[model samples]
Target: MRYVISFIWAFMLTQMVNFVLNSLGGGSPYMFWSGVALAVIITATIAIFDVMLKHPDEENEAQHNH
Candidate 1:
């Protein structure tokens, strides 16, 4: 559920940036690549933060179980 929300948030953010760039006369290829890059960056940042906020005990337990 968190990941799903993150993805949707990233998509919306990318679209907003793409819209602004397009209005400024950016090319289609530039718009597409920029949007993709933004989405990747946003998703990765959210995932990293989520992991950082997770409990250390839970992480250790999961690792030990595996």
Candidate 2:
């Protein structure tokens, strides 16, 4: 479920970047780079949030395993 949400966020961000670039008459290479940057930023943000907001059960399991 987290993976799905991340994918959705990345996709939406990429599309938004593409749209803005297209409206400004950006070239293909520019659009590609914009999309890549957005993807990276989104992925990193999601990872940070996931780490900060861990599930209760996952935390318990980690403690037990350790």
Candidate 3:
């Protein structure tokens, strides 16, 4: 489902962040975990925004109100 896909994307993003940091000589043992935490925060925020913004009945209400 969407949750699974989100997790996959988060992990991949974490990997890429770690790789980039390492290339720039900024890598640390905790950097990967930090990236993961950041990814989770961002993903959760997006998910919440999606839920709040995607109301199927909103369009109907807008049509009636005008």
Candidate 4:
């Protein structure tokens, strides 16, 4: 659920960034922005997933921790 929401937010943000860049005059619209957009997405996913994984399951996972 968290990841799903994070992904949705990422997609929206990337598109919003792309749209804003497109509105700003000059350069290929989708050229560099596509990579920029993907970087934003991957960065967001990593950040969000890191937060989600911060707390270990004390009872189950801790028992198995090596």
Candidate 5:
């Protein structure tokens, strides 16, 4: 579910950038591949951050520290 959302968000972001580029007469010939690459990178980055930041024992650790 999160993956799907992340892909959609990344793809739409790429589309918006492409739209801007096209309007500026600087569009890429590899829009589809570029979008895919951006989506993969964004999704992997989100996943990595989620794993690194979301610990189930965070509250316990905080309590122990206090």
Candidate 6:
């Protein structure tokens, strides 16, 4: 269920950016590449933030500090 929601959210965001690019002065290639770049950045950012939140490394590091 969570994965489904994430996928929908990502799709909506990507499409919104793509639409805006097309509306602006960008060509088809620019729109396509920008949309791809946006998707990759958003996905990576969410994944990294989720990981850090779920497992804070400072706690693990302190445990090993002994």
Best by TM-score: 5
lDDT of each: 0.82, 0.78, 0.77, 0.68, 0.79, 0.70
Ranking by TM-score: 5, 3, 1, 2, 6, 4
**lDDT sort, best first:** 1, 5, 2, 3, 6, 4
- Model 5, position 62, has a per-residue lDDT of 77
Clashing pairs in 4: none
Best by lDDT: 1
Model 4 Cα lDDT, one tens digit per residue, 1-66: 766676667667777777677778564545555745685677676887786787756546767875
How far in Å is the alpha carbon of 13 misplaced in model 4?
A: 0.9
Candidate 3's residue-wise lDDT over 16-45, tens digit each? 877787778855454667778777887887
lDDT, model 6: 0.70
What does candidate 5's lDDT look like per residue over 16-65, in tens digits? Answer: 87668766886546356766787789889999898789877986897799
Query: What does each candidate score in C-alpha RMSD?
Result: 3.9, 4.0, 5.6, 5.1, 5.4, 6.2
CA lDDT for candidate 5 = 0.79
Which tens-of-lDDT digit does each residue in 10-65 have in candidate 2? Answer: 97879786878687885534456667677778888888898899999999999999
User: Which segments of model 5 are wrong by more than 4 Å?
Assistant: 25-30, 58-66
Could you tell me how far off, in angstroms, the CA of residue 25 lies in candidate 2 after the best superposition?
6.0
Candidate 6 Cα misplacement greater than 4 A, ranges = 1-8, 24-30, 55-66
Per-prediction TM-score, please? 0.60, 0.55, 0.63, 0.49, 0.66, 0.52
Number of clashing pairs per prediction, in order: 0, 0, 0, 0, 0, 0
Which stretches in model 4 have alpha-carbon errors above 4 Å?
A: 27-66
Give the TM-score comparing model 6 with the true structure, all chains together. Answer: 0.52
lDDT, model 2: 0.78
